[model samples]
Target chain A: MIDKVIIAEDQEFANLSVQKTMDDLKVKQYDYAFYCDDALAKIQLAQKKGEPYDLLITDLSFEDDGTAQKINDGIELIRAVRSIQPGILILILSGQYRPVDIHNLFENHEVDAYVRKARHDVQELKAAMDALSKGQRYYPRSLAQLIKRSNTYEFTEFDITIIRLLSEGYQQNKIPDYLKEHNIKPSSLSSIEKRLNQIREELGFANNQQLMVFCSNAGLL
Target chain B: MIDKVIIAEDQEFANLSVQKTMDDLKVKQYDYAFYCDDALAKIQLAQKKGEPYDLLITDLSFEDDGTAQKINDGIELIRAVRSIQPGILILILSGQYRPVDIHNLFENHEVDAYVRKARHDVQELKAAMDALSKGQRYYPRSLAQLIKRSNTYEFTEFDITIIRLLSEGYQQNKIPDYLKEHNIKPSSLSSIEKRLNQIREELGFANNQQLMVFCSNAGLL
Candidate 1:
């Protein structure tokens, strides 16, 4: 059960809105902080009291208040909180919508859920909280699509070698010769052609050019 | 010369920070609005008084204050202001970092410059203003990369048709037959092969599959 929650939002209205949503969900023990320093301090205090926070919700950007803060943004706060209480559920609440940055949050920080502060954010926040309570990770649909598209293809070493050769201006007919020179297996021209065709079909690419573009854009090559 | 300017930002502190930067620039007749509706009203009034704003700096997302607003977001405000005064220079000031969205602002919205609200935004905002004064457009380095990557290739109708056929599972050797059936010029097998190789070289793709992937991602086919 998610009984203890802490929200770190710089805006009073946003904080109240989130608190109201938590109240509607019947979450009894919840606290709010307007600064990253205060949020980190609360987490440390709760840990010392032998009752660490169950969930930590924070915004990625916080307005500068002229005072030096140890933790600057939500990502830093997540790192700090995770170090002190590694088991606490972390949910990011922000207006950021960059696909690369959002992908990094899940891949690097291990955030449990991401709720964008948009038009229907209250409802989305509720949904994110519910999913987290059930121990399921939640990603907004658009973000989920980005993750899915980038991760759809799993390239093997042979696939990478083929793509690398292609990107370096090697013709299909010449790739086998290079592979043979490198003592790589399946270096025959027919095998190289077949393997390239198979990869193209798997990726739904109509031609070799399209597959090259996909691999480059997806950072596979 | 930027004689008159207007800023639309919801946060008081952020507005003050922007205002302070403008003050440093010695901009004499600058105004501020906390709501998009009010900003639009100010623009209309300025247009009627024969003293239209020379530039507009606005944030994309505005927190709702319980009352319904017709001009709710910065994009809507931009459209409204453009309709009233088409020549006013528009510069977006926001925390949004989505490459696609930023690209759209340049391609569709006719924005003159975009300054992300980050740590060094004050300096960037000044640089943007300077560029605008000289009748030049300004795009942050990261946003510039997105624009460059997306615009690397310009596909002709013939090129697109070739890629489309390739994507439809037609082998390179068989594409000439389909092209001849369709009455496309240069339908010989060798000619088709040469055209494909040229395109792959132009786009820096090592193979036809990679070219296909690029075209697909670039929305060519």
Candidate 2:
């Protein structure tokens, strides 16, 4: 049960909307901050008071006021809050719709959930809160699809090394010689060819060039 | 020489920051609105007075204040404003970093420029304004890179049709039958094979499956 919550949003109406959602959820112990610095200060103060917040809902983009804030954005705030309270749940509530940026939030920032502020966002926020109550992370469907699509092929170190070599203009036959020189295990012509073929089959690439392109575009190499 | 500008931002500090930028550029006849509806009304009023805005700078996300609004988001506001004054220059000023979304703004909404809110955003905003003055659209380097990467292949209608059929699990040999039935040109097996090979070479695909995957990922099909 989330007894304590803090929302860091700059917009008055957005903060009010979030408050309305919390009210609907019957969550009473919630605080709001309009800036990242204020949000960080509240979290730190709460920690010092021995009454830490259970969840932190924040927006990624904050309007810069030229006040020279220490924590400028939500990402920085999350990092600061995490350092102060390592176990606090973080839910990103913003209008950001970038798959790569959202993916980074989960992979790097350890955000508990991402709720896009859009049509039906209020309902989605309710659903996300429910999921978080059960200790499960929630991601919007589009972001989830992106994550799943990228995770379709789990590229091992061996696969990445081979792909990197191929991307560097190394021929399949010459890869074995280079691998052997580098003391890489299973550095045979057949192994290299088989691995290459396996990767192509797995990724549904028709040729080495296509595989390289996919790797490059997907940011694997 | 740019003269008039209207900044539609929700935050007071952000609005002030934009005002500072405009002041720096010596643009005197500028207006400000806190809500999209208000911005639209201002534009409509300006049109009624026979003096439409020279430029419209808006943020994509607007905090919904629970009051029913005719123009809810910047995109909707842009559309509304465009219908009123089609020749008005639009520059999106926000912290939105999504490439796909930004590309859509340029391609679909006809936004003249997008200046992300960052450390050097004030300077970039100046540059964007200068470009607009010279009749050149300005996109941040990151967004420009995305446009370039996506434009790597200008897929023809025929190519898209072929790739679509292939994505639908149509075999290479069987595509001719489907194509002939649909009255698609170059339905011969040899033609189809050569075309597929040509597409693979163009897109650096190693095989048909890779092409399908790439097409699916790229949203071509």
Best by lDDT: 1
Tens digit per residue, CA lDDT, model 2, A41-148: 899999999999999999887877668888778878888899889999999987654444455676675899988765457777889999999999888777678666
TM-scores for every candidate against the unseen true structure: 0.50, 0.48
- C-alpha RMSD over true interface residues, model 2: 10.1
For model 2, the stretches where C-alpha displacement exceeds 4 angstroms are: A1-54, A58-86, A94-114, A119-221, B1-49, B56-86, B92-111, B116-136
Q: Candidates' lDDT values, in order? A: 0.79, 0.77
Q: DockQ, per-model, please? A: 0.18, 0.09
- Work out candidate 1's RMSD over C-alphas: 9.2
The DockQ score of candidate 1 comes to 0.18
On DockQ, the leading prediction is: 1
